[model samples]
Target chain A: MNSNITHDLAVPLNQEDKAKRAFVTALRVHVLQHMSGSMKNRYEDYVKPEAQKRGNTCDTPEHIHKALKSDFMFKAYSSARTCAQEMVFDVVSDSVDREFETLRAKAKPVAKKGSLTLDDSVEIPKSVSEIDVHLAPGSYHAEYTEEDFATGAVYDNAIEVFSFGQFGKDSNDIGMTLSNYVRLKFPDFKPAKILDAGCTIGHNTLPWAQTFPEAEVTAIDVAAPVLRYGHARAESMGVPVHFRQMDATAMKFEDNTFDVVFSSMFLHELPLKDIHAYLKEAYRVLKPGGLLWQMELPPMNQMPAYDNFYLNWDTYYNNEPFYGTFRRQDYRKLLTDAGFGAEEFMEATMPRYTFVGEEAYKEALSGENTFDTLTGRMDPKGTRWYGFGAWKK
Target chain B: MRRIPRKRRGERNRFFQAEGVDELLSALLRLSAEVSALKDRVYIAEKVLEQQGLNVSDAIEAYELSAEQEAELAANRQRMIETVLAQFDNSSDVDDMTDENSKIEAAA
Candidate 1:
């Protein structure tokens, strides 16, 4: 990558703000790693044994919560996690707040690009508006004024802080990993039109456009702020991506218009009904034999019961209400229900290059990878990308 | 002394049992930012002094610090990254996760 493109694509912060951002990011990593380990130890050492002795099954999320929520270890873990979540917004928002006028001004010209589109009348469902998704303040869609992109700027910085730099330098790993798998899986397929649903900042959207430069990439989100910011982000990086403010559940695109439909870590944020609607819509938009891939959390049923309980903490305590419900559904069954047959559905844990060695990545691409039951349920700090979807035929 | 923007209006964390932790975290971050600013200023001052062919070590030699002052200076002048990481090094939770002590098998 050109140094200039990489520099321009980064969110700018002065010396002091940069230090604060780095501290907050480090703090988040510490809490998630050390503190999380302590929580698990406490559960195993005390809560589980006590519950089992009391003749209660400690296998389900409800049982675990009942036995552990009041424990001091759980409380500390919850507080630290909540504090880290809130502080991420504080750090990023503080860094960006000083240059709010400048960023808002920068967004205007970017939206004027012929490839960018904004619809003022798009509806933001309550599932998005009623709560801050991922505990982010103001969620993704709120705009303080016309052409405001502050929410997107905050998210772009916060995710980097939250991911601890594991999401690639530009946080484009999810897109890059998924696109690589698509090419390796179907070597002959050439998608001419790709649609990325619920593309917040087009971080993942840019990879598909880069992988298939000849193809036209169109990314849609209901959030105007992110769409505006994503357009500017893509422009700054010199990647041509068409961004639109549109709902994923009911996209305005014509049927059989897209050659590929995809999303990354997007479905679990939505309510169950909306997820089904979105899946049906994704099936409707893709052309016959076009691929529909979703990079998401591992399905709950596929994991050991303890891993399921561990990953479901966010659903209960982090304000991600729909996460548990979404993970519990069989992804293959969901796709088959959405009109694709069982044979058309495929699921795999893609090799995360940042975690896996170069040789392992290449081997996995060649279909030499073995996915055990615990493949996708591992820690985020480690490698492996969980994905599942179906082909429209 | 800069006035950072207040958090966005509406919606608070429903999970937290207490309030002051977020404020404390924010205050610590601001303090870190101020310390970083001072460090940057000191770095530039040192560079400029060096350019003028002056050595900072001469000033330190002229006024030797008491043991207490030396320790305080050492703590204050530690690299920001080292100071941050020292917390992790001191953590009991991290120590207990060693291969010999770990109770559960590592994630597959």
Candidate 2:
């Protein structure tokens, strides 16, 4: 159950920290799985009926959110969940503090194969600097000293605890699942250059390099600390990745430079305008006939009202203000507006490569979409990843 | 050591309607986490001692405390209880009272 980080730059946790992480993980599971069920029951049995009496249909996620504002069970669930979120970061940050020097030393060795390019001029976007996205303290950009990667260490370690082992052993299941899907689905298209945009610590980025070893893997993030840690992490793992500190919205890469531009769970953190800008940048950087695939939560329109309300909890409570807004947008239209041919736009629901083995996943791919209320959710029952992309022409 | 900020910016949402309830819940969860950590550490110590060929459970069961040790333990327990209960004590506020009569009355 303690599927903690195994990489070289992994923060060393004492017995108490490990236990705290376990407690937080359990608390999250209880809140998300068990208490969430109770909240839904309360809504269906009590809140929904009460709303109906007043001629309110409770037809949308916003309506459901408004109705549940006064519900005690919902309040308790939210409180517990928020506490778990804070506790996870607190425990991990403590561990990072204890081993700050050790981590810095570990991250010091120059990459033999991989490389890091940090830019001091890149302005930290307000979306990240203004608030701690997902309530992660420091928001992956803060640095106390020159060449500090504590925020990266915090993120890499805290997310493993936060995910509750749902994101695979290395917390790279999103990348692993999506990259493998592209490999299997389109066997003929061999990408020579790959780019992972907004790859925080390259947890999801490294899997793409592993999936396609021949590809020249490059990952970019606006934050320099994460890029520094990610560079060392990739080198320690013996994967050659080019880590650069650059914003995805306005990438430094030339036009048609990459055969594939990928992002996993990155877009939702951006404001609507930034999402569009990032898409345009992605389209510009991708070569003709190349792919721009992203692994994201399913759109709100694809889900029932209740599930929309459930998934959008992060938007309101988790400090991800743009989460619901991104989900509400038409994903296909977003791609088409970015200059991707509408006919070339494609989307798929594939099983998580690590959860369901490769063979089972391949078999499932040709089968039904297999998307339900649990798709893209952190629930243990949610085994599938929803991916949308368009081939540049 | 340089440490990342544990508290995040932005207005924190209050889930409970009553004042201080949310803070109380947070404190309760922290207490629970501490309890769980203690349990984990105990289990880890037992396993580690077992690996070193020490039967911890047997030793613990057979152990007997002398009078001095017992008194020390009792004092320690009392100290812990007092320390925990001291957080709820408002005597410090009364001590800081500017009015002389109110201080004497509060002490009584």
The DockQ value obtained for model 2 is 0.24
Stretches off by above 4 angstroms in model 1 are A1-9, A109-114, A354-359, A366-381, B1-108
Docking class of 1: incorrect
Predicted candidate 1 versus true structure: per-residue lDDT over A1-393, tens digit per residue: 011115243556654455466566656666666666767777888888998998869888778887887676666566656766777788778767777776655665533332678898998899888877777766778877666788888888877877777677688888988887787678799999999999999999998988888889999999888887888888877788899889999989999999899999899999989999999999999999899999998887667666677778889766789999998898888898788889998887877764564577768776743444345543445657888888899
Best by lDDT: 2
Query: Fraction of true contacts kept, per model?
Result: 0.12, 0.59
Q: Write the per-residue lDDT of candidate 2 for residues A132-208, one digit (tens) a residue.
A: 88888778898988898888888888889888888987798999999999999999999999999999999999999
Clashing pairs in 1: none
What range of 10 consecutive residues in model 1 chain A has the weakest lDDT sum?
A1-10
- Poorest 10 consecutive residues by lDDT, candidate 2 chain A: A11-20
Instruction: Tell me the spans in candidate 2 whose CA falls farther than 4 Å from its real position.
Output: B33-108
lDDT of 2: 0.84
TM-score of each: 0.81, 0.86
